[model samples]
Target: MFIEERKFEYWMNRLVSHFETVNRKIDKLSNTENKINDEVLLDNQDLCLLLKVSKRTLQRFRSSGKLPYKRIGKKTYYLESDVHEFIQNGFSKK
Candidate 1:
């Protein structure tokens, strides 16, 4: 069936408007994700790699209370800020 020019233009405009709204929502969600990533938690391996240390050394820090960590079940996680502070305060094995 043949369609009128006006109706076709109207449909195209509506489709474009819908896509614009969807794009804006996607952009907003990405920005929120970036903000969350700023406070990202680091697991044992990530912390070790960042500090260039071994798992045994990390255990020593935790045991001596030199580094702060959160344990959930059998896994341990450290906050990025805490690691930065630990570095700033001069991490040394006693």
Candidate 2:
């Protein structure tokens, strides 16, 4: 009877350890997904800061189609790469 109880306790400990490992994996995956989403939603504010431009100028660029953007419902998002390309194009002599 004592041996059986010991075996049950060992299995319970193994199960608890497995649960903790799975929980950690889930937490890591969630954090990675959040980071990816944050990257995609990096906004005009970040672009303005990077380009040293005003909000009004940024809006003008958006209206003129000089800067491509993503419109998610009413929110506007700009990719960092697009902002860099815009700056590069501004410096181009064509």
Per-candidate count of clashing residue pairs (backbone under 3 Å): 0, 0
In candidate 1, how many Å is residue 66 off?
0.4
Per-candidate Cα lDDT values, in order, are: 0.85, 0.74
Q: lDDT score, residue 38, model 1?
A: 69
Least well predicted 10-residue stretch by lDDT in candidate 2: 33-42
TM-score of each candidate structure, all chains considered together: 0.57, 0.51
Across residues 1-94, which tens digit of lDDT does each residue of candidate 1 receive?
9999999999999999999999999998876521124676778898889889999999999999999988867988887888899999999746
Once fitted onto the true fold, the runs of candidate 2 whose alpha carbons sit more than 4 angstroms away are 1-41, 91-94
> What lDDT does candidate 2 reach at residue 58?
79
Give the alpha carbon lDDT tens digit for every residue of 38-65 in model 2: 4544576766677787878878888888
Whole-model lDDT, model 2 = 0.74
Name the runs in model 1 displaced over 4 angstroms.
1-38
**Which residue pairs does candidate 2 place in steric collision?**
none
